[model samples]
Target: PAGRFGAKTGGRAGSKPGRPGAAPGARSGGQGGRPKPPGAKAFGRERFGQDLGPVRAPKPKRAGRPADEIDVHNPEGVRLQKIMALAGVASRRVCEEMILDGRVEVDGNIVTELGVRVDPEQVAIHVDGIRLQLNEHLKYYVFNKPRGVVSTMEDPEGRRCISDFLKNKDKSERLFHVGRLDAETEGLLLLTNDGELTNRLTHPSYEVPKTYLVQVRGPMAQGVGAQMKEGIELEDGLAQVDSFKLVDSTPGHILVEVVLHSGRNRVVRRLFDAVGHPVERLVRTQVGPIRIGDQRQGSIRVLGRQEVGHLLASVGL
Candidate 1:
């Protein structure tokens, strides 16, 4: 193989003088030196629009942070218990129990952690294998409860109750009375399935005032309004009217408007009873910013958006 080109080509195999087939400096087909490291050729393959074999295995996931720790800066979702309650599944406390009991599912997987957040708008939720209908389209109504109607949905005593009125009304979603008026009392009562609004309205810290129009036996006492305004200590606690105004007056009966913020059972009747003017007829005229507004007795109507908004705003909801 020692030839004229071999001396000038040096020791390298491809450094020989050029010629057909076996040129001294020319290499054919075979690449020189060592091969590339595995998968290194795939680099820039995507840039050239070539198939670089199956894409390189995904980069290994980083490991450092604890799994149990939640990132407060970026929350995953709404709390499972809260969203369930909002969906009218149950009360918040009951929802928590349902979750702990392993009767709740998210995205077809059973989720028992109460802390787990779920995107209610995106995820499918179920309870006890039954799909839950989210109360996304919340409903708020003003029902003018008539006399002899119990405030509750059902009574073991088999008395007439709010369910009777709701029987003919809309049944799209479960609705609850925000507050109660006894069977003998009647007027504007709020009915809604909006858990947040209901919570804020019913919470004691909000001090949402309720107004009542009462027909009571009067004309004997002159300073009755002042006495009721001060306060009347009941067995449970101090019950007081925020303001008292006389709407009409007669010897036999007088119509007065009483405003109070207490939610104690039958507090209104107790207040009038303490004042020595027994209430002949008690009708709740308003709660917060909502009023009966001449809605005939036993008639139910959906509240206007503005009315609902104002009612919520009054309680800082």
Candidate 2:
């Protein structure tokens, strides 16, 4: 008789004792019965009866900030991208791309991750290897100073000066000229509220270069350029041009360009005068990286971001 132990008396060899006609040690809720626990080491069988290896708990999701996120250096300060955009590096979106591309550096470290925060006044930021000016209050400009205008912001004699052209500016800004161009000299001049940069630029140690276009009585002597390059004895000290080139030559006037690192007063006029070709008309064309290209006379233009960066770099700022 078949009992609850599955026909123990007449069960076939190796048959389990679960139920009548049970085959080969089969149990009610064993391998072919209930679903296995997720952590079970038991092999699973696919619908097609293919053997599937032990089920593994889905790899615990990695715990931490994602790769794209950066640790905020200054939680309360402005975002790096925002500051970069304000500093005129580019549009906000473009600045983000630049940061991700690793073209930006904060305090000398290449910053690739986004969401970085910094105090514009505290940290030194650079883009494309050029120092960025982050101070919104510090203004820089290139004024196309016309002839007979004194370089002083205000002249005591009441002559036309830089201040006349700056009447439209905010009175509280307190901007000052970086260096100076004499009353008779005309062309590019830098005006800024950045005192440290101004001092370094004007200092003799930095040797910030200045370029000028000089119109002199023509038929210049053969060795004038060479002699100027060699050195010219000025009332103050020896002065020399870093570069000199004859641009145009006519019957009575010769147009020449000279570049020098001397910031001495009236140095260009004195150099040509010493060489026997007194400057008939003098126009300063460049100061460091800033240029007066096509800028109309007596007009003021804000210095571009790249120009300011280059100017800062020229004096090792």
Specify the highest-lDDT model's number. 2
* Residue-level error in angstroms, candidate 2, position 6: 71
Among these predictions, the greatest TM-score belongs to 2
Instruction: Look at candidate 1 and tell me the lDDT of residue 294.
Output: 79
TM-score of 2: 0.75
What lDDT does the true structure give each of the candidates? 0.74, 0.81
Model 1 per-residue lDDT tens digits across residues 1-317: 33343333233333444345553322333322233356554222222322234446675543433313533211567888897777666799999888778798777777666567766767767676555545457788899999999888778999887777775445546888898888899898899988888888888999999999999876758888888899888888787899999999886889999899888889989988887878789999899889899799998888764575477567654
Model 1 / residue 21 / CA error / Å: 99
Off by over 4 Å in 2: 1-72
Error of 1 at 281 (Å): 0.3
Which lDDT tens digits does candidate 2 get at residues 218-266? 8887998899999978889899999999999999999999999988889
For candidate 1, the per-residue lDDT at 131 reads 57
Query: Distance from true position, residue 177, model 2, in Å?
Result: 0.8
